[model samples]
Target: MRAVNSHNTPGLAGLRFAFGTLTVLPVRVSRWDRDCAGAGMRWAPLAGLAVGLCAGAAGGLLLLLGAGPLLAAVASAAVPAVLTRGLHLDGLADTADGLGSGRPAEDALRIMKQSDIGPFGVLALVFVLLAQVAALYELYGRGWGYGATAAAVAGAAARLALTLAARSGVPAARPEGLGAMVAATVPARQALGIALLVTAGFAAWGTLFGGYGAPRLALAVLAGAAAAELLLRHCVRRFGGVTGDVFGGVAETAATAALIALAVGFR
Candidate 1:
């Protein structure tokens, strides 16, 4: 990989890096500089959008084939895991284990860095996955359009958290690894601006096509973003900064929260 500086302008290379790193897509990234990494994080939401579309299609097909919502929801939930090789789930589990340890920062970070999954990790995965499936099932029952839109919105919003995590002020938890590579790559003001733009677009989408539940769906997206921010703040305080695992945790948590909010509010 070629190393690029933060001053380098990101273009197709950044998008390719985002898709290649974040999903099971077959794109190749040639650049691996701070600028490229920041660009990758900035475009991560597009990768999530692709993942959501795939997941939505799977669920919609299952439903079209007369499968019950439960099975369809499970399939929908599984699609992103398969596409991303369960990377986000692993991060969520590690983050849970680390936080649950209640030890000092160094000790907690050590536990999180370990490959083994602890009891807290296992339980967190179980509950979070179950919640995802349940919420998706309920959303599917509403209609294919609602279910698909919810899935896609949740995915994109979840990834938007990554951009926030990579903002200029956010420090890396360690001097090495992914955190170091992408840390402080994005300006905080730029991240916030992008977030607002995305939020406005989502709101417009909801209002134009969502009918009665438009406001609710928009609120769900905001709620998901809020959840991600909370998780990011917690990780920053607990581990001294963000890590790769922290980013993953934020994605999963935000996605789950968005789906749940949609499930409850879309009716």
Candidate 2:
């Protein structure tokens, strides 16, 4: 179905409708593109919500299928890769090439658009993905319950990281592109939705594991936030701000790190 942005509803479906536009619509949505452009990045987190929940569900199913830790881990990672057609990965590659060149920002951005993959980009993608897989396997090895909790946190937190990356100070690669538009338009309130959803996920998982007794769950999430902040700081220092690729790479990396940390320390 075509995405229709409405001024009428503020319920869940209304939020979902806004999300549908960001995901399904390939070309960047603009006020020019749609009569409903004023919302800006208000809908960016909704996009994150859509992707995170879907990936989390896939992780949930992997746990349900009696899958092994390694297999389950791979499946959880694959959900976003397939769903977003590796858009974030593409960003990672491009951003790596641009940043590694050590040229002007405009030159770096130009490098990002080139069809050929540079060595820096290739190495960055491979190393990052491997790190992620290793982290997920470690989390799953802790226990199915812990693994599930990790997945839910990873799924939600990664998106929250992405939203935050978009909102933070980051010069776009171009004057008006997807990265710029999203950074410009995504509102802080919509970003809060991701935080709420993630908190609820943790709360539910905590309850399932124990009563309010699962205090470690809160700590795990706090670790995720800390990791996200660190990654953002690194990106800002290295790249001078986030690009679309940098945002995706950092999100994926932070989620992986958080899950692994949770697995290792939540004893």
Candidate 3:
């Protein structure tokens, strides 16, 4: 594995690394070492924060222009895809294909590493994207503030999964690639702290924007986190450990669950 760059400053390098790797934003990263990678993962939620803001803004603009909830929802859902160049969606598809194959672990990992999308992948992408759009539409119909908050919180919460997946006990599925490089780099305690911080932020968001009580927001976040943890365990069991695609799948799944929970609560 590549060592951390000695010259680049940690915070700025991490910020640039996070945006550069996670989104299609034109960020120039000066380092590409393991330390920088871990820092980038630690700061992944911040990248999600920016992506969420942009998505919320797009939906809010459409609403301001008198667009219907469905169109606004579509636009909001499309924003993250465009920003990330559909990387997360691709990961979701690949992961689904791998897990759905019902083959041996080696075969499944081989399938996931392939460039082509399979039938299971296509179906997974279609249904998950539809679910997101539908959930956002319901939230949007209630109020723009609630919809925007839900979008933002979901994005942040989704990216927060990366931090959890990178904790000390987690291992990489293989000896190479992004997953192997960053695997087990994050301290477990730091991951737990970050998770708590994110859950707290979600509660604040719900209270300030969704008019949700603290308990409701906490429950929603807990639900999302539980779903993510389950996905992590499944990936570890099936693939021998987490892969980069597993990280993507966990993020998308968590985000969808959180958004759905928030929509139901608001309704």
lDDT of 3 by residue, 1-267 (tens): 988665488877877888998899989888898888888888988899899889999999999999988998998899998998998899899999999999989999999999999999999899989988998999899888767877887788788888888889999999988888778878899888988988887677556643455656666667677888898899899999988898889888888887888778865
Candidate 2's C-alpha runs over 4 A off are: 1-18, 21-66, 168-173, 186-204, 211-215, 233-241
User: Which lDDT tens digits does candidate 2 get at residues 1-267?
Assistant: 977654433443334444544354443332332113324333444465456566556656777788777887777677767766777677777777877899776677678778887988899789867766676677677676565566666655665666656553445545455555445344456555655666565765676776442556655555666676686676566655556666666666666666666666654
**Which stretch of 10 consecutive residues in model 3 shows the poorest summed lDDT?**
206-215
Question: Which stretches of model 1 miss by more than 4 angstroms?
Answer: 1-9, 208-210
* Reference-based lDDT, each prediction: 0.86, 0.61, 0.85
Candidate 1 lDDT, 1-267, residue by residue in tens: 988654335777788888988998888787888888988988888898899889999999999999988888898899999999999999999999999999999999999999999999999899999999999989888888778888888778778878888999889999988878988898999888878876777777787564656677668778888998899999999999988888889989989998988888787
lDDT of 3 at 206: 57
Candidate 3, which segments miss by more than 4 Å at Cα? 1-7, 209-211
Error of 2 at 265 (Å): 2.2
The positional error of residue 23 in candidate 3, measured at the CA in angstroms, is 0.9
Candidate 1: Cα lDDT at 109: 92
